[model samples]
Target: MLSGFFRLEYQNRTVLGEWKKVHWLKWKVSIGLSTIN
Candidate 1:
């Protein structure tokens, strides 16, 4: 039971990390576009 909980926690962390990276990329792209305009 403990192991299952830990696995779920780990998966959540991985998903959160991916989401952060995607958001960061989107932010950078917006900034770049604004600068170009």
Candidate 2:
């Protein structure tokens, strides 16, 4: 049971990390585009 809980937590962390990376990239892209225009 403890192992399952740990796995779930790990998965959540990974997903959150991926989301943050994607959001960061999106922000950078938008800023770059704005600057170019």
For candidate 2, the 10 contiguous residues with the lowest summed lDDT are 1-10
Instruction: Name model 1 segments beyond 4 Å from true.
Output: none
- RMSD (CA, Å), candidate 1 to true, equals 0.3
Top candidate by TM-score = 1
RMSD per model, one decimal: 0.3, 0.4
* TM-score of structure candidate 2: 0.95
User: Model 2 over residues 1-37: C-alpha lDDT tens digits?
Assistant: 9999999999999999999999999999999999999
Clashes of each: 0, 0
Which pairs clash in the backbone of model 2? none
TM-score of the candidate numbered 1?
0.97
